[model samples]
Target chain A: MEKKQSKLSIVTNGLLHENPNLRLVLGTCPTLAITTSVFNSIGMGLAATFVLIFSNMAISACRKIIPDKVRIPAFITIIAGFVTVVMMLVQAFVQPLYQALGVYLPLIVVNCIILGRAEMFASKNGVLDSALDGLGMGIGFTLTLTAMGFIRELLGAGTLFGIQILPDAVEPMAILASPPGGFFVFGVLMALAIMLDEKQGRKVDADPEKIGCAGCPNSKNCHGEGGCE
Target chain B: MLVKSSPHIRDNSSTQKIMLDVILALCPAILASAIIFGLRALLVIAVTVVSCVVFEYLYCRLMKKPNPIADLSAVVTGILLAFNLPSTLPLWMAVIGAFVSIVIAKQLFGGLGHNFANPAIVGRIVLAVSFAGRMTAYAYPEVTNGVAALAGATPLVATRNADLPLLTLFLGTHGGVLGETCAAALLLGGIWLVVRRVISPVIPVTYLATVAVISLLAGQEPLVQLLSGGLMLGAIFMATDYVTSPYTLTGKLVYGLGLGIITCAIRFWATSAEGVSYAILLMNLLVPYINDLTRQKPLGGGKRK
Candidate 1:
């Protein structure tokens, strides 16, 4: 029962408490880029989730064996390998989604969420915990992207998953599908997430000092007395 | 009389007074728009103003902050935003613009004085980008025997290769956004603000001069460039916005020069025929830096190391 509770907390933490996109603000590039359409967001989210879960598990399992000096490179290698696997599978199965995602698919090798999880949680925790963390973080990211996608697609294009929801009389705001609109939606969502978190009395850990060296991937190499500047 | 404190001088020009002056100044343009574009223009203006005030009130209430609508800044923002839109733009879209201007741009940033750029400019750009087709469908002012008609592109768009009637452009009887149509009316309004000392003429004069000089150099008709589009409206009203514009004299001049250069650049080189709003918005972002650069040194102050 204790183990189950711990596992559930780990997953729930990523969903809202430490949402990789809204809270921690990891992997912002993809969050802003592919969220113009619902289909692209889901596809990208699932792809990243697949990479995240496998990468977390692999990193956590090899945590003891990997040297401190070379751990970042090792983590990247593992992440890149999984990202490639996901890319190939996506290309083979879903050609349109693969095309839609385009360079963002390959760029997932360097996504901060995967690497951040590897450094912040997976490296210090057990494989099962790391995997659950990945799942939670992935879902949180997916939810954020989906929400953003829903707004941008609905308002900007007047459509949902390519289905026209707004009547012909109501013109869609074309800007919402564009880059500025993406940024606007992303900012509003982040604000809303923080506001909700605060309202629920879940003290938003915005200060870097509170997150401390534990959150930093370079903490292992830092020789600073108190913490990194 | 009761004994007062030692330093007893105070200017009676409160925010409310200044905003009221701005509204009064905008009357000529509003009247001209009504005469030119007919009653729908007034409807758009009315909807935008009401919506802007409502949004400001609602946001303050929701956030539990003191209501700022009494200051009439939102009313000014509403008028300016309405002026930026075409008369043909849907009322719902105008409300969206108002919400964006009042709530997102102004209130979210700590209300009127704290907004980084002019709220109306931000709203205009957002609407322009969002509903490009609707926003760009300029209504040509043609009142044929008591009925108004929409026809042709704005003078800026139409005059790319051909010259328009200078008198018609000066009088604002051309295709354009509702408020930008009449150069004469905008100038009248601009002069009123300047004369009332509500806004300093430094930014407007410098901005207009720069555009005139640049247009002359670029081989474009300087008079047409100056009189056409939202150049006068933006320079007089939006660029001189106190909260977004620089403070010192030098800062204001620099800001105006930057606005002119960007405006002319966009007009000449870019695809967009009109660049007044975008130029103002872009220059607004650099106001802090401009203010920093042009900070006045005190007497007997030591030079920085």
Candidate 2:
């Protein structure tokens, strides 16, 4: 029962507490760029999620065999391989979404959420936990992107999934569909996430000491000094 | 008498007083716009002002912050925002502009003195980008025999093909946004602000001179370029806004020069006929950097070791 609860928490954490896009603020470029419409956001989210899960599982399974000195490059090679597979599958099945996502689909290999999770959680954890983490983080990112896209599409274009919801007399704000609108929506949503997190009485756990020198990935290299006076 | 801290002195000027002076200075242009654009101009201005005040009051009440409506800054922002818009703009759209100016641009950034850019400029730019067609649909001046004239393009749009008599431009008989039509009224208002010491003349003078010099070099008629579009209104009013503009004299000059260059670059090369609002917005963002570079050293202070 304890093990099952831990597994569920690992997934639920990403849904809110450690949301890859909103909480951790990873993969911001894709978050802001492809979130102009609901369709593109879902396509990009699922594609990244596929790559994320496989990459996390593979990296966790190979963590021991892969040398510490070259672990980063090894992880990247694994991520890039899975990214290519997802890209091909997306291209074959969803041609329009594949085109809409364009360069972003292939750029998922460089998404920080994938690499950061691979380094932080996957490499030292069990393969099952790593996969769970990927699933949760992926859902979080997808939900956030979809929320952003929903707002941008509705206000900027007065449509949802390409269907007009507002009356014809209502002039949609065109700027909401542009880069500035994307940024505005992104900022407001992030604020809402933070506000909700606070209202739920769950501390964000930003304690500096917890994330300081001891928690740093470079702790081993810097001899735990971290250059602080 | 209650003893306070030593060396205490205070000026009679408050935010309310200063904003009132600005409103008074804007009266000539406001009257000119009403006469030129018809009573709809007054309606537009009234709606924006009321909406701006309401938004500010509501935001303050919701946030539980001190209400700032009494300062009259929102009134100034409302007038300036309406001035940037066409008279034919829908009333609802004007209210949207007010919400942006007051709630988003001003209050969101901590209000009044803390706003990074002029609220009106942000509102104008957002409205322009969102409703390009309506924002640019200029109504011709209706000063002839009290009849609504046909819709026409602003003089800036026709600058290349036609030579508009400088007098008509001076007298404010033209198709343009509400306040930008009359150079004479704007100048009158600008001079009033300067004489009242409410605003320094450095920014407006430097901005206009730079535009004049650049226009001459570009082989365009300098006077027409200076008098056309929103240049006169922008240089005289918006660019000199205290909160967004730099403090030091040298910083002010640099800000003015940058505005002139960007405005001319857009007018000459870009697809847009008017660039005054955009130029001011861009320069406003750079004020902090300018202030840092031009900060004055204390008297008898030496360089840090």
> Could you say which candidate leads in TM-score?
1
For candidate 2, give fnat to 2 decimals: 0.92
Error of 2 at A202 (Å): 5.2
True contacts kept of each: 0.92, 0.92
lDDT score for candidate 2 against the true structure: 0.89
Candidate 2 structure quality by residue, lDDT tens digits, A186-211: 87787678668877886544444677
Give the winner by lDDT.
1
Least well predicted 10-residue stretch by lDDT in candidate 1 chain B:
B143-152
Q: Which runs in model 1 stand beyond 4 Å of their true positions? A: A1-5, A205-229, B1-9, B143-151, B302-305
The worst-scoring run of ten residues by lDDT in candidate 1 chain A lies at: A217-226
Colliding residue pairs in candidate 2 = none
**Which residue runs of candidate 2 sit more than 4 Å off their true CA positions?**
A1-5, A202-229, B1-8, B143-151, B300-305
Instruction: Report the interface RMSD that candidate 2 achieves against the true structure, in angstroms.
Output: 0.2
Candidate 1 residue-wise lDDT, B1-305, digit = tens: 89788768878889999999999999999999998888999999999999999999999999999988899999999999999999999899999999889988888778978998899999999999988898987666765654322336677876785677799888887778888879898899888998899999999999999999999999999999999999999999889999999999999999999999999999999988889999999999999999888888888899743
